[model samples]
Target: MSTPAPPFSGFPAGALSFYAELEEHNSRDWWLAHKDAYERDVHEPMLALLDGLEDEFGEARMFRPNRDVRFSADKSPYKTHQGALVGSGTVLGYYVQVSADGLRAGGGFRAASSAQTARFRAAVDAPASGLALEQVLQSLRRGRFEVLGERVKTAPRGYAADHPRIETLRHKELMVVRDFGAPDWLSTRRALTKVRDTWRSVRPLVEWLSQHVDSDAATT
Candidate 1:
């Protein structure tokens, strides 16, 4: 049996301002100076959010705040946001992030490995599976979720440029996003509820991708 999630009050006070200030002063010095506020206003509330989500969404993993700067010219010392994943293993599962902009949530594999991509294209080209995927994309659009991915200008080699499913075939990765504009509710428990509802709405698409495009899908 699953344990009940703990009651959560809301994001800690000044969570938004902390991110905003971090954006302006994105340095180790600035973060060290205000680390206490980060703990109280940002990290703690993120933990509460994850705790509240774990029961229904599975284990939630918070990302590190440090930015990987080894290969990038823009070397900001920290991320401008906090992101977490609910679920385990290689599946992309439910994700939620809070930034100075607002909260964003939803799920899907952002990119498929070459082997997975071949399988995904096979399914996308097949009549039955292709139709099913189209319907899923349509449903997501109707629900105000933005379907996103890196796309090639032309259809992949085997598919015709003008093929009925060509637009989808051009995609190298796929995911959905639901932006919950920063509102008063973001500072309350309602934010958790909002994220839960959006995740639920997109769960089918997540499942479909796991079943069709994940590495294990090839075996099945």
Candidate 2:
């Protein structure tokens, strides 16, 4: 097996502007020319952030870069940017996708799928695990959160008007969300504080997600 990378310390400032310029010239050739900069500026910093979180929370998995293009035509090899943080419970971590236009965030202890949702629901619903469920639900109820995305006036074309996920999300708003939670009040406070201290490192990337085009409408 490949050795896992270490947790990240934080993101680099100006990473968002670098990505924005690259997106303006979106092309395989451009990516090849500028991929190194992305690694140095964006990816590496994100890796540091993830590594830092991992030191405190355990390993965090990264999403694959390959877009599932069977449902769409706009296939770009690399994402504009990335972000993530630790969550409470066995889930351990959450991911954020930062592009030019918006950001969205979600997580489950189980794999990310319908089956995982079902499993999460079951876990939360377990009578014997009421305390555990209460911990998760309580964190969600805190509500001081951020969604990264642009302000849109209408729904984008090619998606069904009533698609469940689309209907649930506000139109013209695309954001990568990072839900925060902890095992206890002290831990929660620390997590949020650390996130705040590092906010400048990741905020630009999150802002970028709201400004760029989302290529995963069908799957999103």
Candidate 3:
């Protein structure tokens, strides 16, 4: 039996200004200066939420906030957002990305150090992985998906070209599993309930895909 999701009541506070502050300063120096507030007000609460989730799901993990930005030219010292997971092992926990808009849920199950983002992109494009991809797309199609950031112009798969969520999809790497439609204001209890409900709905499809993939692998 899957564990019940944590209560939504435990969600972090002051997330909007935290994101705004990061964007406004947009530099390592500024983050360093404001590090205490960021950790106390933003990181700690997020970690607590993750801890609650981990207690329920048995495998969610939070990545350390110290980002490795040495290879990139952008040089932003801190992540503009935060995240956590609810599953275990190589298959990452159901992932969540928190920004000024709210909390969004999706998968972030990648293993490679160098090509993690690329693999996610490929997964979205892969016909075999389309089941997971389609679940999300269908939600967006039904207008159930919410855009957390500023609205944009492009539509998702089912919507017309001018659909608002399109812009959010365009800004982020759409293939990455960070597009789940959770709202930040949702209480942790409610969020957990929704997660369980969603997982129940999708589990059969996920299992079918797993079996199919295994059979194909054996044949190959």
lDDT top scorer:
1
- What would the per-residue lDDT of candidate 1 be over residues 1-220, giving only the tens digit for each residue? 9976447667754877899999999999999999998888788888888788778878877878898888899999999998886653434677888888888998876553677677777888889988999999899999999988788888798888778999889887788999986888898999989988999998887777777886342110
Q: lDDT (CA) for every model shown?
A: 0.81, 0.43, 0.49
Candidate 3, poorest ten consecutive residues by summed lDDT = 211-220
Per TM-score, the best of the predicted structures is 1
Cα lDDT tens digits, model 2, 1-220, are: 9986644433333455566776677667887887787777666655655566565445655554344566677766555655443442223234544444333344322223333333333432344443443443344435444433333344334444454344212233222344432223211224334554444333433222222221222122
Error of 2 at 205 (Å): 25
Q: Which model, 1 or 3, shows the larger lDDT?
A: 1
* RMSD (CA, angstroms), candidate 3: 9.3
TM-score of each: 0.89, 0.50, 0.55
Evaluate residue 100 in candidate 3 and report its C-alpha lDDT on the 0 to 100 scale.
66
Per-residue alpha-carbon lDDT of model 3 for 1-220, expressed as tens digits?
9976433453455665677777777777777788787776566666656665555455555655556777888776667777665543434335566666666665423332324333433444455564555565566446444323222255434334643333333322331333443365353556555555544443433343233221111100
Which residue pairs overlap in candidate 3's backbone?
7-188, 7-189, 8-187, 8-188, 8-189, 9-188, 9-189, 87-93, 105-180, 154-166
Q: Against the correct fold, how does model 3 do in TM-score?
A: 0.55
TM-score of the candidate numbered 1?
A: 0.89
Worst 10 residues of 1 by lDDT: 211-220
